[model samples]
Target: MFCFSCCMPQDNVNQEPSTKPYQDTKPLASIANLSLKTDSTRQRYVAEEIEKLGKNNISADIFTFHDLSVATNNFDADNLVGEGGFGRVYKGRINIQGKDEDVAVKQLDRNGFQGNREFLVEVMMLSLLHHQNLVNLVGYCSEGDQRILVYEYMINGSLEDHLLNTSPEKKGLTWDVRMKIAHGAARGLEYLHETASPPVIYRDFKSSNILLDANFNPKLSDFGLAKIGPVGERPHVSTRVMGTYGYCAPEYASTGQLTTKSDVYSFGVVFLEMITGRRVIDNARPSQEHNLIEWAQPLFKDKKKFHTMADPLLEGNYPEKSLYQALAIAAMCLQEDAASRPLISDVVTALEFLSPQPGDP
Candidate 1:
């Protein structure tokens, strides 16, 4: 029900707070006063926005700082599961709905680029959007400088871990599983783009953001950069460009204008990475092969060379015809012109056909 255009003032939407590094010279009392005031202001804004958007029944639980601290074992280093520019994620256990549940706790660094605004947006978006392929938000802790998020634990970790950076102990993802992951991840994007009330643009879409459970079921995570798309007759939403490098679409990188097609292009980059088992931008590779897209574009023009793009780790066990079809889908998504890219629904349909059949695991 939250339409960015109709529910909120344009000037108030997508405004990022200007932040600077914390200085030790500030007096303790002054800093404390400022923190309290900022916290109160943020809470007030969240209340007002939820009322405006008619999302007062937001289901995400609210947690206290002490609760998360206890769940994460007083923020021990050994429990750490993942790390990023924003903060570190820890594997934790907490009771939810009268049942003991494992969770991934993301404790945002107060000094990081992702501040209160990003936190609010992520909380709001994930609180409202629900899909099987989308990670569920367990709760959040927004006490003072603490901006932590709790999510369902992904036991299998990320697609990047199994696909791009496979270790000796971790088995490589099979062709069927890879295709299944593609289908699930594509479905998540399709839901965000076509089904969400206002149609969200997943500004950041990459392998690492796609998490997996024990069964290799993929779920999309990290909604901090998501934005509501232009509604009504608007062609696209204009905003400052923000997303992972190498995966960003050429048009969006150059022009801040964004649409559902931008996410399609990013998904293409990730799909190609899954097939080739290579990083989007790796300097260690030969100069010509440094950029994955640049190297794969020429090969896509000829069907005979499609086999060369398959991940060598696959050991040629995959179906050749399926490889060609998958590459063709990626090529269409990676098209230079945004207009030529397929909608996420089309991508989902294509991957669904390539998915594992009923019996075989």
Candidate 2:
């Protein structure tokens, strides 16, 4: 269910606003102007923008800084769940209507890679889009110098945790689970590409952004890089190239021409990661084998070498025929020509056939 709630800080009404010196190194004047000469003015501008979004029927909770502070136990390090270039995500519980729900609170670090623009894009995109395979945005907080987003907590965390950073005590995902995740993620991308009005290009698609629930159901999160697809008669949306290295489409990387097919190329890279259990770029490997796609190109051409691409962690547990079918789909998606890459819907169809049945081993 897509819903939002607003809460204001009740405890600090009478206290004087802090007079401490602002320490953020970046000049406030550069942040969308709106006369952000002071922290209070910037907060007001952000709040107004959010209010305008709400008026436009973009449903999202307006949370006060105090509400999130309490929800996250004052953003305690103990509650931290994940951290990246953008900022840290903390596990928090917030009251939704009458019920207390666990949520992931993503607070933007002023010094982080992303800032106001990315934050606004994510809120607007998530507010307007909803899908079973897409992460749910619960609410947001725009309060004095604080920019935070609230999302439904995914119990199992990101695919990266299970795939690349598994510890000695943690068992890797089962073959069935991996197939399920791949299929679910494909569906999410399909929704964005085929169903959404004007379409949406998921400019960033990688394992780290794919989150899994307790049931291992996959949902694509982090829409800050998303852009509406090109309109009729246009081949692609020409924009600045910005995406994780290794997963970006070759054509898009070179020409800055973004199409839904660019996302297909990225999906191919992630699917390859699932099959091989190797980083997209692993410097630890022999120099020649550093790039996974480069290393797999020859193997992909020969049917006999296909087995070598399967993750050893699978321990020969997956069905051989299923592996072949999956690799075939990945190869199609990874085609050098963006025009040659299969549509996300087609990828979903192929994955549907590869998904395990009820009684399958």
Candidate 3:
């Protein structure tokens, strides 16, 4: 078999550090005030962080705010990707030393509480882990206080970009694309929950956060809210509740006890999004239908009613067995008792099974 991806494996590529004619090394965003200590230890720590991130199939580069500003044309709206609780994500590119290739950059707000930690977590986790289903983080910049995380450009944007606003009349994502995206995103989350050292708990999972590439493959992003699960015998991490509404697991939301299952619950919500093409919470919807989780919870078991929850774009072409299997997996994930929810590994297994295989559906 031949591996055709343009990228080939390398043991560790030290991202070509700047040896340029310019000197203004600051983030292009607002995080321009961080007073980095000159100690070799601090530099080593940041360097190690970058190397660790690079090992997981992510390329790495450290750009100052000056470089990013030049790339984004000063945060022009045309370069914007999207916005959320953190800040607007701008699309830009930076050329690191030696590579002679430009890479996509994600610039976050300097002052946003969600910027720093999320920047580092995304840097640390995404760089160390590799999977076909997960997105790749190319590199990041934390010059001064201006933090910017970079990833390979994902075109077609996010699942949210297509599902909710996409026209049902035309230009809609096909049923096949949606299922593949769901399965891929689930696999990414599964890798985070089960494969990383010390095991990471992805507190957030939603359509808007799942980015898509040119082929419509989904990549999970935004790890600022991630929590490192206990390494020993502890079953969960007790933290202040953090996550977008509607997707938070019922038990984790109520009790603040988080485990991999908590993420399973969130993955279920994403699955529901794949099936229904609606935001987890939408006020414009009728009051009766505004509450997505509550409304969909019951129908998950009633196979006869499954079609009602499906996205209209699907035009009723989904496989009954696949849809039912997906629904059943989601039902277990959303179980009120956290213990009842399946592990992320199990969730991925179920999703993989439901997806189209080598043969016919």
Candidate 4:
């Protein structure tokens, strides 16, 4: 069990004191100044920002810290389910709209890579976006220095847990389940690219960010790094390069110019992972096979060799034609030229064809 709170800094006596509260009339300016002050003040400013943005849009609850604490049994170690760069996720039951429901509570680590800025970004993004393939944000807690987010609990946890297993007793995802997950994830990305106003680029699209429910339906989670897509005539948004290594698009990593196609490229890597059941980066493997793409690239040219790329754990159970088509989509997505990458909608269409229908052998 991963405990984020246990990793918090114990000594805060030397921290700077909070400055005088700024007027709400200029909330943006006030937030800018507040962000430079004490951590507590910054968290308060984040809460204010969330309230302002959520005035007309957000339906998520503004949960009290005490209530969430009680819900997670004070974030007991036994409740811990997952951990990330942001912090630990705990499985808990909380009453929402007067009904008992299971939820995953993501408590922010004061010292983690994610800070108040990422916290605010996630709240703003998830509050406005809605899709079956995207994880639902139930509520959040931003009191004092504690920043926590509550989401609908995913029964199967992340795709990474099932795909890259270390336990010998664990069952690998069946071919049908893998295709289902791939299709679901593609639809989620398609929604972000085509449905949302102003569009959204899911900057972080990795196996770990893909969560699965009890039915093995995949939902994209962790929108802290998500950015608004370019508008009007702008072809791309220029920003600092940020995303997990091995999953980021080569062009975005090199130029810092981001577009919807960048996400397409990342999805390609994930698609490859699904087909091969290998980590993007693995030092444990032979040096020639350290990177999944570098090793798989040569195999893409020869259809006969595609079988070699199929997860050994599958034991040759998947359909050969389905495997070829899936690999074709993956190759198209992994194109070196960002312009060559197909739109997410195209990817979705291809995946829909690949997914098996009910009662298919």
lDDT of 2 by residue, 1-361 (tens): 1000111122322211112221221222233453333644555665676767777765678899899999999999999999977788999999999999999999987643355656767887787777888898999987756789999999999999999887778898888889889988998898888777678899999999999998899999998788888879998989889999999999999999999999999999999999888999999999998999999877878988889899988899998978887788888788898887778876776676566645676
User: What lDDT does the true structure give each of the candidates?
Assistant: 0.80, 0.81, 0.68, 0.82
Ranking by TM-score: 4, 2, 1, 3
Off by over 4 Å in 3: 1-59, 96-103, 168-170, 358-361
Q: Which tens-of-lDDT digit does each residue in 65-145 have in candidate 4?
A: 889888999999999998888888999998988899999999988764356767877777777677888899999988777
What value of lDDT does candidate 3 attain over all alpha carbons? 0.68
Question: Which 10-residue window in model 1 sums to the lowest lDDT?
Answer: 1-10
- For model 4, what is the error of residue 129's alpha carbon versus the real structure, in angstroms, after optimal superposition? 0.3
Candidate 1: regions farther than 4 A off: 1-55, 359-361
What clash pairs does model 4 have?
Answer: none
Query: Ten consecutive residues with minimal summed lDDT in candidate 2?
Result: 1-10
Task: List TM-scores for all candidates, in order.
Answer: 0.86, 0.87, 0.80, 0.88
Candidate 1 clashes between residue pairs 3 or more apart in a chain or in different chains: none
Candidate 3 accuracy as TM-score: 0.80
Which runs in model 2 stand beyond 4 Å of their true positions?
A: 1-45, 111-113, 357-361
lDDT of 3 by residue, 1-361 (tens): 1111111123322212111121121111111211253333343444445554445444466667787888778889988767776667777766656554434567666664455546766665555556666666666776765677767778778888788767646477777787778877877776666656566788988888888888887888777677777658887888789898888987788889888888888888888877888788989999988988888877865768877877877788888766666667667767787777677666655555555544665
- Model 4: number of clashes? 0
lDDT of 1 at 183: 87
